[model samples]
Target: MIYFDNAATTKISENVLEEMMPYLKENYGNASSIYSLGQKSRAAIENSRIKIAEILKIKPSEIYFTSSGSESDNWAIKDILNKKEKNHIISSRIEHPAVLNSLKYVESKGIDVTLLSVDEFGNVNLDELKNSINDKTGLISIMFANNEIGTVEPVYEISKIARENNILFHTDAVQAIGNVKFNLKDLDVDMMSISGHKLGAPKGIGILYIKDGTEINSFIHGGSQERDRRASTENVASIVGIARAISDASENIDENIEYTKDLRDYFLEKLLNVDGIILNGPIENRLPGNINISLKGVKPQTMVRYLDMFDICVSQGSACAAGSIEPSYVLSAIGRSEELALSMIRISLNHNNTKEECDFVFDKILRGMKKFKK
Candidate 1:
């Protein structure tokens, strides 16, 4: 199968799997326990935390592991809202459903939210983001890179604005972790969320980087896990796998970027000549691994089904919201019409994707278009 759905999730690497095996088998002890086996597990978890912090150039104490990106996002958003009542939230409309849904829930709780609009190229306006913040603004949550369209937001600039306004900033970097360069210290973000599956680690594990001294209330209140911020037994095996994946990805990120960019450009070049094809995001500033396009007159679901028949994998929108059949808010935020949004398909690549697979997908898309034409 030609897999082009890296944005949804990535296949875990063999190295990561190898690193996780011992934890799953003999070292399966609760991290909070005081016994030898538990101490060993706890030590491994702390070491992995340190490694992840090194990779992101942040302090190990600042990193908190979560169940997934959604949980991390929820914790960040809800903590802010709970701590400061009647505060305004600034976020882009193109954010992943995790952030968008969290903001929606916050709004339902009587918190004012400003869903900032993106330009046609899927770029958020810096001025608009700046103007959205006021004394009542508590937090600004934006995505590092768009999952569907691949457009990289000006997160550094937005974070700076948030800092100047004394509002905390958070970014959902789930799709950007392995595909883009990220330095938590360099960016003025107060918190960031990352999912392991998006970076070739096992699913159901994620990281939340909360800058030191950032005030956040507890989400899951039970035990003293995650510094009492979140209460759950740690997924030790998955955490090990995530740390391994992050380390490996960081070491080879430059090569991955170059290789994927070549494949992405080649694929786009082949499809650009096709009739009624519109690229959804900025051509240059977007992620090298992502290519979102709308095929005029063809519904995204139809194209997805056609591709699936050929053993090709792709997505119509964010996998979290796939079954809804609703037009993607990300596309809509970028000024795409409802019909165009419905017709959009995202093709995300990974280091494992080959030139041959790209060619096959191109041919399949062309054939699918011909059938649609008839």
Candidate 2:
């Protein structure tokens, strides 16, 4: 199958699974135990933490593991409000459901939330963000990159604004880790979230990076795991897999960017030449591998299912919310008509995708769109 729905999830690399094998088998000791075998598990978890921290140039103590990026987002956003006296929060309209729902929960409790609008290119209006900040604004939570359109945000500059105002800044970098090159050492953002599955690790593991001195209350209130920040027995195997995935993705980040970008450009070049196709997001400032388009008369679900018959997998934005009838909020936020939004499909690539796969998809797309027109 020519899988192109990477933004939804990825196949775990063989090396990552191999790294986790021992943990799943003989090394299946409790990470919290005092026995030598347990200590071995603990050591492995810490080592993974250190490796991931080093990749982002952050302290190991700052990286806290959670079940998923959604959990991490809930923890960071809610914890900031919990620890602060302010009742106001700021975020963009294009955030994932994790952030949007978390904000909604808080709003129900009387906290005011200001959602900044994005321009036609799916970029957050910076001036609106600056103007919305007041003494009561406790935090500004924005995504480092959009999941659907793959529009990279001005996180560094936004972090600077947050820093100047003494407000916490958090970014959901789940999709940005391997897609773009960024160093936490150079960025002044106070918090960020990442998921292992997005980087070729297995599911059920992710990291929440809270910079030193950033006040955050605990999310899960049970065990003292994750430095008392999160609770639950650690997934030892998945944690090991995360280390391998991070190392591999970080090392080849530059090469992957060039390869995926080339494939993406080639795919788009062929796709744009088709009749009655609308490109979504900023053509110039978009993600390296993300290509979102609207097939004017074709419903996204219908078209993707058609492609699925040909073993060409694609998506309609977040996999978490894929089956819903509602149009993509990311597209709607950027002022797309409902007809276009319902017809939009996200074609996301990865390092493993190839030019041949791109050509095959292009040919299938031409056929599919022609059939739809007929």
Candidate 3:
């Protein structure tokens, strides 16, 4: 199958899998134990943490592991709210459900939440963000890049705003880890969340970066894992997998970005030849592999299934919200009409895809559109 829905999740790298095999086999001792076998597992976990820390230019103590990006996001937002020091938070309307839902839950508990509006490009208005802060605003959570539309946010500016106001800043960088390059020290955000599955690692591992001395309550309570902050047995194999995967992605990011962007532009040029196809998000600052578009008078689910029949995998919206027959909230936040929102399809790419695959998928899409002509 020619998979175009890489934004949902990517295949695990073969090298990453090979590196993880030992941990899954003879090296299966618990990381929390004190025996030699356990020490081996502990050593692997710490080494992986150090590797990831070096990539982000942060302290190894600052990185905490969780099961997924959703978990990391929930921990960052909920734990801060649990601190009870702030009753107000700010976020964008186009954030992934992980952040949006967490904020919604807190809002139900009488916390004031200001979901800033985005422009037509799904970018948060920095002015609105600046105007929303008050003494009670203790934290600002925004995504580094959008999953559905792929618009990269002004995170450096956002970080500066939060610092100036003494408000904590957290970014869900699940989609930006491999697509956009940034060092944590330069960006200077208090917290950032990353998912291994979005890049080349396995699906059961994620990381949350909390800057040194940043105080937040712990949601998980158990054994002394993750410096006694996140309590659970470590998934040693996946941890090792993610460290290697991220290191490889970081080392070759420039080459990957050029290749994917060029291929995506070529595909868009061919696909937009058809009439009444409206592209979503900004053309210049979007992710290298993201292409979202709307076709009038057609249903996105129908098109998705049609492509799947030809072994071409695509998506209607975020996989987290799949199987819900609703217009995309991200599209709505960006001022798209209900009809256009319901008709949107996302075609995310990766370096593994080729021109021949794009040509095949474009031909199938042309036929599908012709079959459902308005």
Candidate 4:
């Protein structure tokens, strides 16, 4: 299959799998134990933490591994709200469900939340963000890059504003981790969440970076792992795999960017020539790998199934919320009609995608559109 769903998850690289094998087999010791086997596992986890920290330009102590990006996001949001009463949060309308759902739960707890508006291009307004902060504003959670539309937010500026107001800033960087260059120290963000599966690592492992000395309550309670921030035995194998993926991806990010951009641009150019197609998100300032297109008079689900017949894999929206026919709240938030939102299909690329694959997808989609039209 020609997979075009890199935004949802990437195939695990062979190198990462090789790096993880020893831990998954012979070195399968509990990191919390004091025996030599346990020490070996513990040392591996620490080494992975250091590797991830080095990639983000932060101290190793600042990184906390979690089960997934959703878990990390929930921890960051709830931890801050639990620290005090009368909490308020500010987030954009286009964030992943992980952040949005976590905020919804926080709101259910009587905490005030302002779902910030985005412009037509799916970018948060810095002025609105500045206006949203107040004495009770405990946290500001925004995504670094949109998963569906691929619009990159002004995170550095937003974090700076949060710093000026002494409000904690957290970004769900699951989509941005491998696609963009991130420096935790330079961004000044208090917390950031990243998932391994979004890169080339295995699933069920993620990282949450909390800036040094940031006070937040723990969501899990039991063993004293992750420096008392999270209480769970470490997934030693996945941690090592995640580190290897990050290191490998970072080493050649520029090359990947060029390749994916070329593929996206070529595909979009072909699709734009088709009749009654509308492109979503900013034309320029968007993720290099993302191409979200809305076809008139066609359901996205129908198009996805049609493409699947040709062994072309894409997505109608976020994989987390897939199989739900609900009109995407994200597209609606950007002022798209329910029909337009229903017609939206997202095609994301990666380094493994090729020009030939793009050409094949274009031909199949064009033929599929013609068939539907007839």
Candidate 5:
């Protein structure tokens, strides 16, 4: 299968799986226990945390593990809202559903939320962000990079405004972890969220980074874990898997960027010229592996099914909301009409995807496009 839905999830690398094997076998033990077996698991989890922290240039204590990016996102927003009696927060209209839904739930509780509008390229207007801040605003959460359209936000500037105003900043970096390279230590953001599955690690593992002394409440009440920030038995194996994947990805980060960018550009150069194809997002500023397009006059779901018949995997939008009859809210937020939004599809690349795979998938998509020609 030519899997172009990598923004949904990636194939776990053998190295990551290899790192997980020991914990899944004889090393299995609760990290909270005091016995030697448990100590081993605890050590592994802490080591992985330190490794991930080192990669991001943050302190080990700042890293909190969760089941998924959604969990991290929900926890961060909820914790912040519940901690202080603050009633206002800010986020982009183009955020992942994880953030959007969490805000929706809290909005019912009398808290104020401002979903800032993005430009046609899916980038949040920094001026709007600056204008939105008020004394009641406790936090500002915006994604570092968009999943559907792949537009990287100017988060450094956002962080600056948040910091200057004494408002906390959080970014959901789920799709930016391995695909985009940056030093988190340099950014003034208070928190960031990452999902292991989006890169090379297995599912059911994610990370949240909270800067030192960031005022946040705990949503989970259980045994002491994650420095008393998150409460749950650690998934030791998945922790090691995610840590190793990040480490490996960082080692060849430049190569990954160059290779995937070349393939994505090549693919778009060929595909965009086709009649009725309209490119989404800012082509120059988008993620190297992301290619979103709208086939004017074709239903995205129809094209998705047609491409799948050839074993080429792509998607209409996020896997989290796939198959929903509603038009893509991300597309709509970026000014796409309902019909144009419904006709949009995403083609996310991966580190391992090759030119040959692109060529093969291109022909299949060409045939599918013709078959659905208006």
Candidate 6:
């Protein structure tokens, strides 16, 4: 099967799984236990933390592992309440549901929220963000990159704005972890969230980077794990898996970017040859492996099913929001009509994808367009 849904989740690397097997079987123990088996698990967890921290150029103490990126996003956004002085938050309209829904939850609790608008290409307007900031605006949570459109936000500039205004900044970097090149230290964002499954690890592990001195309230209570910040029994195997997966992804990122960009461009070029095919997101500054487009006369779900018939996997939009009857909010935010939004499909590539596969997908897509177009 040709898997074009890497943005939703990636196949776990064999090397990562090999490393995790020991913890899953022989070394299975609670990290919080006082025994040696538990200590082994505890040691593995810390070692993974250190490796991930070194990769982002931050202290290991600052990294906290949670269940998933959604949990991380929720924790960071909810932490705003801890700062009673800061009653307002600024985010964009194109954020993943994790952020948008969490904002809605906070809004229910009397916290003011201002959703900044994005351009047609899904780039958050820096001018609008600057104009929206006020003393009451205590937090600015924008994604590092959009999941559906693959638009890389001006996060460095946004972080700088937040710092200047003495407001905390948080970025959900789930989709940006391996695809985009940036040093977290230099970016200087106060909080960032990453998920393991997006980068080749299992789905049960995630990390929230809380910079030193960024005080936030605990997310999960009843335990002393994660330096007492996040509470849970550690998933030792998945933690180790994430460390290995991220290490490999980070080390070979440059090569991976070049390879995926080549495949993406080749596939996109071929797809654009079809009449009435519209590309979403900016041609420049987008993720190397993401290709989103709307086939003017076709429904996205129908196209997805058509592709699946040939064992080729694609998606309509975010997997988290799959099956919703409403059109893509991301596409709509970028000024797509309701019909165009419903026509959108996302083709996310990875290092494992090849030119031959792209060719096959393109051919199938053309056939699908002909078959399904209204």
Write candidate 6's Cα lDDT for 223-296 as tens digits: 89988887879999999999999899999999999999988999999999899899999998999999999999
Which regions of candidate 3 fall more than 4 Å away from where they truly are? none
Looking at model 4, residue 48 earns an lDDT score of 93
Model 6: weakest 10-residue lDDT segment is: 78-87
Runs in model 6 deviating more than 4 A are: none
lDDT per residue as tens, model 1, 151-198: 998888888788778888999998889889878889868999999999
Query: Candidate 5: misplaced stretches above 4 Å?
Result: 83-85
Candidate 1 local lDDT, residue 219:
85
The all-Cα superposition gives candidate 2 an RMSD in Å to the true structure of: 1.0
lDDT of 2: 0.90
TM-scores of all candidate predictions against the true structure:
0.98, 0.98, 0.99, 0.98, 0.98, 0.99
Cα error, residue 213 of model 3, in Å, equals 0.9
Compute the lDDT of residue 288 as modeled in candidate 2. 94
Compose the digit string of candidate 5's lDDT tens values, residues 1-374.
88999999999999999899999999999989999999999999999989988998999988899999999899888765574566799999999999999999888777799999999999899999999988889889999999999999999999999989998899999988888889788986898999999888999999888899987777788977988878889999999999999999899899999899999999999998898888988988889999999888888888999988888899899898899989989998988888778888899997789989889988887887888867
Q: Give the range where candidate 3 is weakest over 10 consecutive residues by summed lDDT.
A: 78-87
Error of 3 at 345 (Å): 0.5
Against the reference, the lDDT scores of all candidates come to: 0.89, 0.90, 0.93, 0.90, 0.90, 0.93
Whole-model alpha-carbon lDDT for candidate 5: 0.90
Task: Write out the backbone clash pairs for model 2.
Answer: none
lDDT of 6 at 308: 94
Model 1 poorest 10 in a row by lDDT: 78-87
